[model samples]
Target: MKARVTISLKNGVLDPQGKAIAHALHGLGFDNVGEVRQGKVIELDLGDIAAADAPAEVEKMCTQLLANTVIENYEFELLD
Candidate 1:
């Protein structure tokens, strides 16, 4: 099965990297873009894992190491 974990900053949290990206975009003439929030996608090829178990397993990995739960939130989805 294939899976994906998306990690993002919680609401009201300041994101300097996101700001930088927005700035760069505006400089490149993308002036209509609004606030840009940044996040990350982690793809996994969980070979041989059951479809029912992949989401939970990837979520555990997110809680343990992939994300900082204090200021970040994560969600996982099974792709196949």
Candidate 2:
């Protein structure tokens, strides 16, 4: 099974990268661009975990390392 972890800054948290990207977009003529929030996607290939348990296993990984739960929120999807 394959698992994908999507991690992003929690609401009300500052996002410097997102701010830079938004600024660049406006400079490049993307005037209509609004708030930009940046996030990361981590794709994992699980060999031992069963499909039904992939999400739980991946959640553990996120809590351990993939995401900084203090300032970020995470969600995961399992794929065959």
Best by lDDT: 2
Error of 2 at 3 (Å): 0.6
Question: For residues 1-80, what per-residue lDDT tens digits would candidate 1 score against the true structure?
Answer: 88888999999999999999999999999999889999999998899998777777887898899999999999888877
Candidate 1 runs further than 4 Å off: none
lDDT of each: 0.90, 0.91
Candidate 2 residue pairs in backbone clash: none
Q: lDDT tens digits, residues 1-80, model 2?
A: 78888999999999999999999999999999999999999989898777777777788899999999899999988877
Number of backbone collisions per candidate, in order? 0, 0
TM-score of each: 0.90, 0.93
